[model samples]
Target: MGVLLVGGLMACAPAVSGPSQAALAAPRVALEAGHPERLRLVVMGDQGTGTETQWQVARAMAAVCAAQGCDLGAALGDNFYPAGPREVTSPLFRERFEVPYGPLGIPFIMVPGNHDESWLWGGDGASPRGAEVQVAYSRVNPQWVMPARQYQASVSGLLDLFVVDTAPLAAYLPSVRPQERPGGPWDAAQRAWLAQAVNQSAARWRLVLGHHPLYSNGKHGDAGAYDHLPFTFQRGGAVQALYAVACGQADLLLSGHDHALQLFAPQPDCPGTWTAVSGAAGEVGGERRGRRPAAFEVYGQPGFLWLEITPQTLTLWAYVVGEGGAVTGTEIARLSKGS
Candidate 1:
């Protein structure tokens, strides 16, 4: 079946199966072709299930990027769902990552999510190579670009993105998932690296990327029952890291874990740091709710985020993908830093 994207782009990519009846039942939005911005990038997370919904979203992203000439695609963790792949040669890799996203063509800058680190816990009965296997896979696939668990990259004059390994660090903390015991010796080291990296970056925009959010409206939000009180109970890493980013003059933070589309207004305390949650890419975890903190929030709906940056302004678009794979978008917000 052909799904049309904005700009007359056809979305007839091969899927393991067609989108479910429920997805098709939802309201459909027809997206227009091509964005007006010069530089564009796509961001989304929690999309590694290899389901038809995931394929639909992938096809939408591929079409949008193709129509507008995108520079890169960012996967905000949860790259592989459940326990992650056992090895680079695992069939899960082909079905989940290679097949769905191979059509996009742009390099995917990714981070590891909690599900991606399930292999770290011996009791889970998952392979121990979850994290390393993905990094290894990146060596083979030119499109998958994860150099290290925690590293930073710059797009010359546009931005500098720092991807962090938050799972192991959260596991190291006392209040954060004490039962899981994700003990890795690198928690302190990653924290240190994040601090230094944010402070040292000289790019126009400094974006910190990770799977877990510092603040979210979905299940991980401060008010939610699941992963409750993350900011206070979890180690000082997330808060400290945000502070560092704000201190370094960074305005935007991108993350996924909450499984929703959320845009948080700047905190009264941290005036310049705006957080965007685009986890609604592949799957919806649960309800999204945050009245005071969230500038805009959408739960259960599945979509990805489009960010376009010119020399002076950055505009964000939230593209909603229907069950039939048609994409409709809205201009959610924009930011401008004085030149």
Candidate 2:
């Protein structure tokens, strides 16, 4: 099937699975989309199969999102672990998701992860294919939705985020390759669109959120995940584009596929300052047996990322939720506005 984006207005490409005797229902909102003024949003990611951890992570972030009175929440990727198992609209999503995040009652905008697609693509149509998965997700969980393979969200117009799917980071490969794939107008369209959005908006920050990592010291190897065969997260100058987004003086960018957390300041190599890898939503471990990176200030823990913003300053934190639903991991970063 073709990429079916339901919220036609937004870049929502949901994988569509045909006819389900039972499916999650999506609440039809007017065919309208706009960014409100001075809004607060919650961003989290990589809450894989860690039933306990994902739950704790959701509860904590939900509280913050609710308390902050934010209308949107973000998730990075690999949402469900061990390769999605094809049957996406299962209790796994509803029970694990609709049940917990529903209380927040806000629109949860998300991107696809290697896990989100799962075994569906590996000859598992009965399990639910691409856009169909999205359709199912929307059907089962109205409070949540995926804006196509790529989409855009303007944070009060002050910030415009281009969310892209890096799953194909390394183009489509039968062997679960390492790098990202060459995408459609998604990345290019996003960059060109960003140039226009930034010039048009009176807002101070322009950020990008996705499931992959550009600058990371975590489990994944270097900047490029070519693996000597194929795949390049650097496709279409992906990394350059990411940095360009910041070089253009965009405030910050956030992502969550690494299972750990990271923060970057204005360094010589990068002028505009960047921070990301905040997933830790629920899983305490990563794709490779919970190994902690030597360079990571905090690693191998269960936590979530939080962002508190205002006209004057922006504060970001990492909360490590521990045993008995306990949270111990916390890191804060304060950013200043560019003149």
Candidate 3:
């Protein structure tokens, strides 16, 4: 990836192609000048391990939110370990989620990951009940939000978030256990919902959040060729085609499954959107496989992402946490039509 400067911050441009000169010359404008109030959000994923690292990341989040301000949180997925909770009342909910992130004092829009939908392990798909339990918990706790497997949420009138459940789509791929396949047509319905929801939404910014990534530089790789399985490559191609609606229309595609923090510049397929992977909330330790060129990529560290959005701009700060759960360095990116 080539180096690009944004607001005096050095960022790696996508390796596939360089950005336009106009984008590189775009000025770093102040977010508060004659613009709508900015919305602050914290994003993390694969964090339901109930481990010390998860607590550490949560503490960092609390401290950051305390110093700054967070209006909402986006929990990408893998909410539960091994398998999801046995039921909505399972103690894991408290020990893993409620207790660790309770101090954030904001609602977390959540989606389910492979582990959350699996029965024995992540590879073998389990009953949909695992994910349903999480959705049911939404009624019990206002902070835990998951109205359905796939839903749309409008946040503070600035963002329209379209959440997708990609576990079944991956599980439904070839060479997977038969029992893991979803009972009905899930992919079609989700694609339809996303295409319609994004087109109809009137919000200034649109984001699609999911458990799996459309593009990643970590081990799992992109939507196609996940885990580098060649047989599934074709199926993964279908997966990418399904997400074309959001890739072409939405402003950003955010996900977490690679257990690392990554930011990729727009790709040829997903030209209009940026790809962000923040899956290192609890687990950390992965090689930058370099499956794709990334604007920013980091591994073996536990951290999350912060975003400040206004009608005209969306600024991203990728925070890297050190051994003591303290922020070490920040990579900033200011994105707009010109940038």
Candidate 4:
């Protein structure tokens, strides 16, 4: 394990209801090269449970941002659970999303997760159009931004974040003959947009975000059932999307679906782009390791990622939250021009 442990925390933002004060005293990790000169982003995924655990992580995020400062906060899809809300004004909106994260006070950039798109898959799914509702929310809430299903957010001079919809990438969609379905055309459009975005981005750092992990080590690892379900470009499946478009261009691809936190370096087959799974913000799930060892893996722990990007270095800190809102283990990774 290349993980490092730290002791002592610089008091987090005012304590919340859950996690005791003692448990919230864990060390707060900071970058060694100092704070980011360009952008600071906090990324979390699969965190829409609206449980105390979710609130705990959100509290930690608020504290960390308050202490270190953050420009934006992003959700790796799955903003809701079971099924999406019935309408833009659905009570679930305020309960699951607004209540917990509203205190952060930063614009939240989001993409729809598989659960958010559950309606598309089956029964009574029409009530809440998770994807559509999120976009509509952006109109009223300044902090919530998911302007389009497939869109890009540029952090000015530093990077471009291409947020994509990956629910359709599941093998099930086309299995039902999508050409005749509503999702068929949209799926094709998404693929085309992804390929073009990766090629056209001229930013110093190009990061692509989707709800599904291109590669993962938890329940949905490379050896998972969807492993061979190829995307438009790759013969095998979703992971190939990164190689097809992000080969020598994109710097990082972030996703959350596995309910675990993982970091994978570029492998021989998929070179140049680094993939990370930050899905443990609210859920603490099991892991199936050794199938494909991640550069770093942390499960049975709910946490989030702090990404500090500068011109010279891109540093990521995987902060694990324990009992209260304290950050326990902080796994750090730094990437530069060349390996």
lDDT of 4: 0.67
What TM-score, computed on C-alpha atoms, does each candidate reach?
0.78, 0.71, 0.84, 0.79
lDDT, each prediction: 0.64, 0.54, 0.72, 0.67
The alpha-carbon deviation from the true structure for residue 194 of candidate 4, after best TM-score superposition, in angstroms, is 1.7
User: Which residue window of length 10 is worst by lDDT in model 4?
Assistant: 7-16
Better of 3 and 4 by TM-score: 3
Best by TM-score: 3
- The sequence of per-residue lDDT tens digits that candidate 4 reaches over residues 68-165 is 77777789988877666657888888898888887776666687776776655531122225676776776666566676666776654467777876
Candidate 2 to truth, TM: 0.71
Global lDDT of model 3 = 0.72
State how far residue 210 of model 3 sits from its true place (Å): 0.4
Residues 85-148, candidate 2, lDDT per residue (tens digit)?
3455466676656676767766666666656654435311112244346535664454566535
Q: Would you list the clashing residue pairs of candidate 4?
A: 19-324, 78-113, 230-237
User: What's the lDDT for residue 110 in model 1?
Assistant: 76
Lowest summed lDDT across 10 adjacent residues in model 1 is found at 24-33
Candidate 2 wrongly placed segments (more than 4 Å): 1-38, 63-70, 85-89, 119-132, 139-142, 171-202, 225-249, 267-269, 286-296, 329-331
Cα distance off (Å), candidate 4, residue 46: 0.3
lDDT of 1 by residue, 1-339 (tens): 443232222222211122232321111111122332345778989898777778778888887787765666789888877767767888987888878877665566777776776744521222224666787786666567665656665554466677776665443234233332233334444555566667766667778887777677667663112254343424424434433444435668788877888887777655778878888777776884554567778788788999887767888888888767788888888988788
Residue-level lDDT tens digits of model 3 in 102-177: 7676667788887888755653434566777897797677667676777766644567787887786666333243
